[model samples]
Target chain A: MSCNIAIAGVTGAVGQEFLRILEERDFPFSSVKMLASARSHGKKLTFKGREYTVEEMTDKSFDGVDIALFSAGGSRSREFADAVKKAGAVMVDNSSAFRMDPDTPLVVPEVNPEAIKDHKGIIANPNCSTIIALVPIWPLHNANPVKRMVVSTYQAASGAGQAAMDELALQSKDILAGREARCEAFPYQIAFNLFCHNSDLKPNGYNEEEMKMVNETRKIFSCPDIAITCTCVRVPVMRAHSESINLEFDSPITADEVRELLSTAPGVTVLDDRENNRFPMPIDADGKDDVYVGHIRQDESIPDNRGINLWVCGDQIRKGAALNAVQIAERLV
Target chain B: MSCNIAIAGVTGAVGQEFLRILEERDFPFSSVKMLASARSHGKKLTFKGREYTVEEMTDKSFDGVDIALFSAGGSRSREFADAVKKAGAVMVDNSSAFRMDPDTPLVVPEVNPEAIKDHKGIIANPNCSTIIALVPIWPLHNANPVKRMVVSTYQAASGAGQAAMDELALQSKDILAGREARCEAFPYQIAFNLFCHNSDLKPNGYNEEEMKMVNETRKIFSCPDIAITCTCVRVPVMRAHSESINLEFDSPITADEVRELLSTAPGVTVLDDRENNRFPMPIDADGKDDVYVGHIRQDESIPDNRGINLWVCGDQIRKGAALNAVQIAERLV
Candidate 1:
């Protein structure tokens, strides 16, 4: 049976990427429905040369839809996700609203597809930076069994949403043109600088993005005992998020063995050739579906035998958001 | 007694910055002479409102120089630094050539000013990323000894050399203007992306920048037990380098205790204000003398609360290179 799909929040950066990737990947869809905010209602969007009208998401939007993909903000999902579930469509949510919920299943199909079966009508997608690190971490963890992870990410501005992307482009132009950059989306000048502060700042000192990496990785890997610490900063890159991860595993593992493990791992590509300056870079990873990893080495600080260091880069909008969501929809059948 | 200062590689980025910062900081110079390669000879440079002619840096250039600052690449320093020293000048070297040499005194005055007294003629400056990370880590390590470090850097193009910064600007315009990016300074486009490969890949899987941080921090802190695993990346940032440092200390240290310790550190300024989104940013730290640090918190992954996470930003040309060198020169008295 062909799946009837509905895309909620169909106008943001990730949302458009979802539409494009869905068509490009040729996911089986009998019919597709698009939903956005009230302002975008009746707007026409073309996918695969077919024009679809975006409707304002409502309680009845999911009726007769077999799989509903939601990328709306957390508040929007909190207000309408229950209604979407009641409409008899399974939901793959892209917000943090239900990710930490005990009843919700957080799925990274490559790492934990079985988690989808336990979902009570809704499955949650992990954070962009979290998924970027997970693509490499899962394989390593699967092989050596990671006991702890310390990830420090150099994230792109796009993860703050489309306006952040526009802000980066605008501010960069302003700086280059000798004009004072006026920042609206971020707290500081983003042209030649970075700030680790994202939208959410908790009393615990972890930003919302860093916390998501820690919590979501545990949930996706299904390893509660694993310890994770992260510091996420926004870089000047427009599309991809890169992470430097240090893992302490339960057993000894060499860099060569880890590279071999990642060569076959789904959604991961090893780009480690330091002599030739070949490593995962955002300029190369933009618009790509797979996560790129390089600089793989035995962590010399920890027992070199029990330690590993890795660098990962991926288009945040693709693997971190749109592509992963589409991968979940593809697995729904 | 008055001091005569000579600058080696007078036309480069760090060399130029050294000239400007010396005038601005009123570095106690009785006379100044500029020296460069034959290619840059005859070039006119203005320092403190005086135009000085650049001369070819031969064996005779260092003759009456009491303190010579060198920012030329390794080869030139290898050839001229010894001559500069034989001519009786105590050299403050910014090249990597003498940094790892057991006889050379590598100094970041804030962390290891005392090392300058042992200099055989050339005192070395730590790498840019290394100094930025050490600015924050040293204060905390002094208060509550750091046992190990896991660092991931978001470094600026300026660290590569003056040409790198120019290449970043020109390529930024090229990409924005719809032209193929010019990439003579880097392997890939530096306009909107970052590559984790810095120069000099070692057999240990660490780049030169990473290895410098690991080795220099030990010599500076005098703690051989403190291990560091790092991934140094070249980002599109223009002037400063920012590091995400996860430090494991011997005893439990709270975030509040760190705040007090760093607030009075010799070369650090505390900029931690998460509520108002006030923190250390490269744009704000640019042209500044000290390293700017913020976003300090206890890392959750480590048991006994011995882990702390901090973000540090500094002008690589200033505190990371020129100013640190000047500080070592001051200690030479």
Candidate 2:
């Protein structure tokens, strides 16, 4: 029996990736409905050799849908999420709207799949940087409970959505053409430069992206006291997000033991080995499904096995967003 | 009364910047001599309408020179630094060679100017990322002795030297021309991406860049036990190096207190104000002399005021490299 699936904010970046992953995975789906804001109504998207037109989302958008995936802005979900649950569809939200909600289960299938079963009609997909960081981190944290973490992310333009990607594309083209790059969609021109500032600034001095990493990590790990700090930056990279994570664990962590843990982990692929000059790069991880991790070892400066330094790279649009949501959907049946 | 000056590695990136800064700063000079490798012996450089020809660096390069600025690779200094000093020059070497040497003092003028009186003969310059991190951190560390630090750097092409910058420009032009980027200077194309790996991968899995930040900061602050861990990344930025530092101290730290400390710090320029989306960025810090710090706040996610997060940016070629060396030179007199 195929599942009747619904996608919320069907016109957004992560939502579109959700559709692509679902179709590519050949998910057991009998019917599909795409819902977006009023502006995107009548827009058509194709999935699994089938075409679906976008409908204006409302309180009744999830009626008769067995499962709903949401990637709309937080405000949209805050407004209509209950209506989605009332309509009998289990919602998987990719917004910050309900991520830290005590009732909401923020699920990274690789990290906390069991959390999916307790979802109150919504499973929260993590922030792109957080998702990428955990792909390498969770396995190690599981083997040796991570006591603290410090991460710095080199994120791409696509995380901001299609418009920011477009800005990067155009600004790159302009800079190459010897012209001053234009700025829109981002606070600055997205040429051959990177900045720690995100589009929106948070009141507490952390950018929205940085705050997401801090908050989402606590929820996914279920470790409220795990010290986490992040510096999130938007690089000129087109697709993938890369994170340099330093983990301080409560238990012993050797390179061999950590490698053994990761070798058996579901979503992580080790790429370390400095002799041949091998490590994961965003270019190598782009368009791939798995998170590529490398440079794994203990940070000697951190005193003991408390410091595990590693790097992670994955397509933010895919594993960090869409594919993760689809994997959660597959678990429902 | 003019200052006698001698520049080592006159053909290198930081060497070139040192020459530019000296001209721009209008430093008093009775006689100036340029020194480089045997290959660059005949090269003539025009600095502020004065023609200086490169001389082959030998034991006599520092004869009668009051201040000798060294930017050659580490080997040269390891071999000849003592001889240069014996010739009676206050040598400011920008290499990993003498930074950890016990007798040579490491100075960042702005952070530890009083340490200048302690230099025996050679004064070491800190790593680019360390300079940027300490520029903001030393002020806070001064307010309260920073017990531990975790830093991630978004470094620029110029820190890798002139050839790396040239490689970026050339590869960018090649990518624009629809040709495959030919990367000879870096392990990967540095146009639209980030490389999580550093050139100096060590047996302990920590890159030399990371080690420099750890060891150099300890030496500069004269705090041997200060805990430090760092991850260095090469970004697409041309000149500035940005650091995301998570500092843990013994006492309480507040955002207001951080602002007050940074505002009065000698080399620090505060650019933080969250409501207006204002913060330090590379585009603004490039070519500037001081380090720009922003996004200061208490990291409540950790226990106590044990955590404080900050973002800092400075021209790697300036404050991180040449200008800092010049600043040290100024204090030596």
Report the C-alpha lDDT of model 1 over B208-263, residue by residue, as the tens digit: 88888888888878888788888888888888888888989999999889989998
lDDT of each: 0.86, 0.84
Model 1 per-residue lDDT tens digits across residues A276-328: 86888887789998999889998989974898999889999999988998898
Off by over 4 Å in 2: A37-46, A50-63, A79-83, A197-203, A301-304, B38-41, B58-60, B79-83, B118-120, B176-178
Report the lDDT of model 2 for residue A125: 84
Q: Model 1 chain B: which ten-residue window has the lowest total lDDT?
A: B324-333
Model 1, position A60, has a per-residue lDDT of 88
Residue pairs in candidate 2 whose N, alpha carbon or C atoms collide under 3 angstroms = none
Q: Give the TM-scores of the predictions, in the order they appear.
A: 0.98, 0.93
